[model samples]
Target: MTITPLHFVGVSALLFGIGLLVVLTRRNAIGVLMGIELMLNAVNVQLVTFDRVYGPERLDGQLFSLFVITVAAAEAVVGLALILAVYRSRGTVAVDDLHELRG
Candidate 1:
């Protein structure tokens, strides 16, 4: 069994495009957060693909990907917390509607 770098790049590109579309089109804070996550996952896929293709010589990419995943998880927690706080304070999760900073 073999996987080509082109395939990984194509998948990563697709995921990145989808994430970009989501970020551009969504108004909800949670939806925007999900877009950011998708973008991060796309980058992770590229990192893992490069690591696998380059063997031991490219271990740093995989290690960085692991760190990225960890950071992404922490970001999700913190981002959700902020979103909740914003919702409580603003009474809405729409990014445009949160301008007043008041509920």
Candidate 2:
């Protein structure tokens, strides 16, 4: 069977849902970050699929995906750094234990 745009959208929605579930259920900082990445990738997939359907001659979707990747990479770096620092100081990466930072 040949794949269609609907297939891509279905897969993207599934991926986004999985990522949202992970983000909501995960306690570890790294796990949450991973979930965010998954969500971002899902969005990228949707962008590309729509671009293909609407205007295959343009590179807008690919360009936007690339920008998202760059932002995601930077976010990962900063998030990891914060997580590392918190783990070093607090001895845990659990979200519940981070309330100590609250004023």
Candidate 3:
């Protein structure tokens, strides 16, 4: 049988769930950022799939996905910079070790 929208949606859901799990379980800042990126990619997949199925005449979905990618890139850059600064200052990137930010 040919591929379907349902399949794409299921894959997206699975990806999002995996990303969520990663974010919740990781103790490292870089791992959390990777999870966030995965979640963003899942969203982009869903957007493009739906757009392909329902609005093939327009590029709204693709455009939105591109925007999400751009945002994700910016987030990665900023996140990595922050992580680097934090590591330099605290000598670690573990989330649990960042107790200074809780105050």
Cα lDDT listed for each candidate: 0.91, 0.94, 0.96
Local accuracy of candidate 1 as per-residue lDDT tens digits, 1-103:
6768989999999998899899999999999999999999999999989888888865978998999999999999999999999889778899888665567
Instruction: Put the candidates in TM-score order, highest first.
Output: 3, 2, 1
- Ranked by lDDT, the better of candidates 1 and 3 is 3
Per-residue lDDT of model 2, residues 1-103, tens digit only: 9999999999999999999999999999899999999999999999999889878689898899999999999999999999999999989999978775566
Residue-wise lDDT of candidate 3 within 17-103, one digit each (tens)? 999999999999999999999999999999999889876689889999999999999999999999999999989999999886554
Error of 3 at 71 (Å): 0.4
Off by over 4 Å in 3: none
Pitting candidate 1 against candidate 2, the one with the higher TM-score is: 2
Clashing pairs in 3: none
lDDT, candidate 2, equals: 0.94
RMSD of each: 3.1, 1.4, 1.2
Query: Predictions ranked by lDDT, top down?
Result: 3, 2, 1
